[model samples]
Target: MGFPDDTPPGLAGVLATLRGDVEPSSLWATLVDLAIRGVASVHCCKGALLSGGKEYLLRWNESSSLAPWEQEAIALLEGKRKGTEREVSLLSLFQTLAFGSKGYRKALEGSLEGAGLWSRERESQRKRVLLISLLLLFLGLAAFVVGLIGADAWLGLPGARAAVAALLAGAGVGAMVLFLPYLLVGALSSSLTDQGYRRGLQWRAAAKALKEELKGEGFNVERWGGDRFPAYSIALNLTDAFQEAVKKGKITAAPPWFSTALADKAEVVQFGALIALMTASSTGSAAGVGGGGCSAAGGGSGGAG
Candidate 1:
């Protein structure tokens, strides 16, 4: 009832009469109810029409459930007398019809195309953020691990512990000053580059192609005819080429096994299971149960020692 002034006065009057039966305070709720119960395809006979520039395009698909009574009701709504069923009989009598049933199809196709483009852009942005965060955590941990392993090996030298300690300390200082900072910078630049890769102009081009595909399908006409927007599901079949490119990148940019959080958590659980299994197996063979500290042999040749 609160629609803009552009709405037909007759339509407004009809709405006003309908609303008068409801409580005055429930006008907003009544409108909301109407919006929620948005129009559905009533009958296949009541098809959508599409207007393509100056030409009037009509596409008619008869519903299997269409009844003679419903057809009569449509004719009555069209101000036609209840008589014949065939179009040829009606056409012979009247020849001034301007619009056909296919007009609704054209309008629906354009709307669905625009929706597809919008959803793609949103998904691309979401992937970019997730990829950048992963890159950051991985590179940071790699730098930290290199620092730990280098210290462990260098500082554990045999007959020159003090000298080895001094060397490892100097190496640690150098890593903090030079290598760590470089790693941070490299990680930052690479993340930006990778995110930019997915945001390439190619995705936009693909979305444009999808829009064209929908337009070609003649699905646009009846799709947007009702109050509810119609959706056209488009499946992209780019697996082979896309996965090949991703596989090639993985050869160069694959994160270490320990870098991923999910992998690390799984590894922790697996390690516990492995230890439990080994202990059970060894104890079963020895005929002992739940004991500790079995000496393990070092792989070396020390015969007389």
Candidate 2:
């Protein structure tokens, strides 16, 4: 089958290649390969497979070096299998591959917003501490000056010089004691602000990398309200020209069993999901083959606040 007349060249081209004269077994193998490549591209997990008829298992590649927060975010995703090394649900894995870095992007966005807020707050606190410290020092110096002048005028003797010196020393010592705590607090707050700023920058850099990766894959990528808002938002519009081709009967739908078998045997369930997607695309049916349609491939946000 051929793509619809209006299909975009990028997507149409990919579908045309996939739908070329090939055996069902060969098609399945191709899908499996694509699925593995897709997962590896994001460096999230190795692959996924159906397990026990009702569940899907996603395996994490131990070789992949993930950030601590990334690991935590994956753990929080639904269908996580405890005690298993980096295994998640087939559905979750499928969503991740189909969408490409949405989960990580979302997590990074939230972290960036939080860190920014903390940095701002800490900066304000440090300023306040410095102001208070300066005020105390100034008041102490002013009082010492007054005491020196009063001693000279009232005592009118050499002994008054000693008294004035003692007074000055005591005032200096008191000022130092009062300033120390505030100075320490100011330093602490400044350090905290720097740390928060660094964290925010890290998150932004990670999100930017993910966005660039998706763009490299030919997805239409857009960033919205980042400059105006703390939580930077991203939107991905997948080239659905392939879906349009399927809907127009320009491509042949994969066999239902093909989707099922692919889902069951592939290391990553995304391959099976893509196969199922093909069935839905070709038939122009919202109904999925073995399970649901791969319509989730459409662009969407991980969310921002």
Candidate 3:
């Protein structure tokens, strides 16, 4: 049940290793190291999260499976119960640096803006549709009332009451036909807006959390004055040097479980399969069967786990 000889360690493997019974502090340290590696990778690929040291918030705009890994790592660190002050501080530092990277920030801002615009548009459309539907409904009711008032007077005229009743019935049906579609549209628009608003809030919170964490870490954060992406840039520190080392291969990027011995072969396989399932569930990818379970750990060991 051991991983195949060709199988390489990946984020899933690192996570599996961390899932072992390790001390909380050790786990947090490993996570921090991994976060550093991730940030370093991004720095090497793209420039810093700022332009001209003052203008534009550079964010990661690329799509990769690695994005989820960073988030999961942060969540894991946050969930630790007996975490040390150092661990918490390092975790916040990692999040601030990793999430504040150019590519990551770009993606987050893009998502936030898109969701915000969509929500606002849908909300406005919903309101318009609802107003129109309500107006039609009121008009229909008024027509019905008018018909009833005329019915008593027309009753004395031959066939006049019947004609008025027919006209009112047609008007009511026509109004309903017009109202139902608009009602449905309004409901759909409302739902879209609700979903978009939620997504926007989540992204905004992530950005804000990163900003606050940087401040807590004693980094000099300043608002960019240049006409570019509205982002706060921070003073460079140890993270910049560490990223340089990572790029130069002076610092070996190790998996979270580098020190931990491999688990029982059967357990390893089971864990690999479980990771595969989880990854598939998150990414909507098809779960591979049997030996394909090892695919979860197929990528070379690097970056954040």
Residue by residue across 77-124, what tens digits does model 1's lDDT show? 234322232111122111212222122222222222243312334334
- TM-score winner, 2 or 3: 3
How would you encode candidate 3's per-residue C-alpha lDDT over 165-187 as one tens digit per residue? 65885687678777878877665
Poorest 10 consecutive residues of model 1 by lDDT? 51-60
- Which regions of candidate 2 deviate over 4 angstroms? 1-56, 67-69, 77-79, 82-86, 91-106, 110-239, 242-260, 263-305
How many residue pairs clash per model?
18, 5, 10
TM-score of 3: 0.26
Better of 1 and 2 by lDDT: 2
Model 1 Cα displacement at 139 (Å)?
A: 1.6
Model 1 residue 62 lDDT score: 29
lDDT-based ranking, best first?
A: 2, 3, 1
Whole-model lDDT for model 1 versus the true structure? 0.26
| Index of the highest-lDDT prediction | 2
